[model samples]
Target: MKNFIIPAIDLKEGKVVRLFKGDFEKTKVYSSSPEDMAKLFEELGFKRLHVVDLDGSLEGMPLNLPSIRLIRKAFSGSIEVGGGIRSVETCKVLHEEGIEFFVVGTLAVREPRTFERMVELFPERVILAVDSKGGKVAVGGWKEESSTSPQELALKYENIPIWGYLYTNIDRDGTLEGVDTKPYVEFKGYTKKPVLASGGVASLEDVKKLMGIVEGVVVGKAIYEGRINLRELL
Candidate 1:
């Protein structure tokens, strides 16, 4: 499989933004147009795009479909979206709107059966988002802590057709400090599934370090803050 350096375009109230450590109140708007950012990522040769509807994640449903639609219209590359995707119906809607993959989070751990059904239906298009903090899964936009550990959760779906896991360190998300590869290494060791690392990617070196262990890495703040150049990174 080809490794990916996916740029994340987080949407909040129709604008591109990034939140600090998953805190909604602590957010910084990077751009007013998500479509422009998506187009730029595609122009820079990124094969895939990671988009999250921050408002939808908090509200328990997709709230930025219009923004997503605009992004799809602007960028022809593969798109993988998350945030408040908790049901099969929502996935179907996004699929119809040109989304290539669905990153299911809150529903994956809280509703395994539903998630399994989605995997069965979508096949390789369903990726599980295992957002973690201190080694445990955090759900509902990182507002609710679950008893499930990332390893345990990955193990539970070992036999399923789910595409892979997007393992994010909630504490490091949008922090731009660096990444802790230990958790990703451990999760991959236990499940042997394709893993995509998210959060704390500060520089090209950070991306290179994670490339060895993860199938891909989702970078946000670093790219927006001009800390890493997408053109050069690609």
Candidate 2:
């Protein structure tokens, strides 16, 4: 296991921000220039990034396309984008814009057939995002809850040719709490696809705890809050 530590950038209103447990009202703006932040991550030698459009996730359409275009121009590494990508055309557009992977959650749960078609068209470019709260899968930017559990959803798409999974713990997200490995540990048993842990990663030790278990971890609040030194990942 490479223990890939991918940093995250959450965009809201064309600015970089982090929301507490997926609550838009509880947001903290970290930077006004997202591309500059992307460049900094590239300078830190990070090979991948996890970016979400908070506004898009709620509106069901990409509102930060201009900012994302700037970010694409600034960073050379692989980037996975999520939020309001509900159709294949949007995926195609983002792919043309240089995004390597699409982190899809709401679409997959709301319309599995459409999501499958996306995978069929893009192949290894789809990353299933299973954001969970109290063991149930949360959707629509984590504003709505679905009847499906993370395990069931993971297994449902296990046979599909997706890039991998980005499993986030909504309860721990942005809380600065230490990561809970049990959920990830249990989630791993359901599928063969590589899984990336996200939410509430407070320190390097938390990253170390998840090393060799999942494919990687997507950390945002911890890194932006200065709790995690970016260089240490190298």
TM-score of each: 0.97, 0.97
Cα TM-score of candidate 1 = 0.97
- How high is the lDDT of residue 219 in model 1? 88
Pairs that clash in candidate 2: none
Backbone clash pairs in model 1 (N, Cα, C under 3 Å; residues 3+ apart or in different chains), count: 0
The lDDT leader among the candidates is: 2
- Lowest lDDT block of 10, candidate 2: 1-10
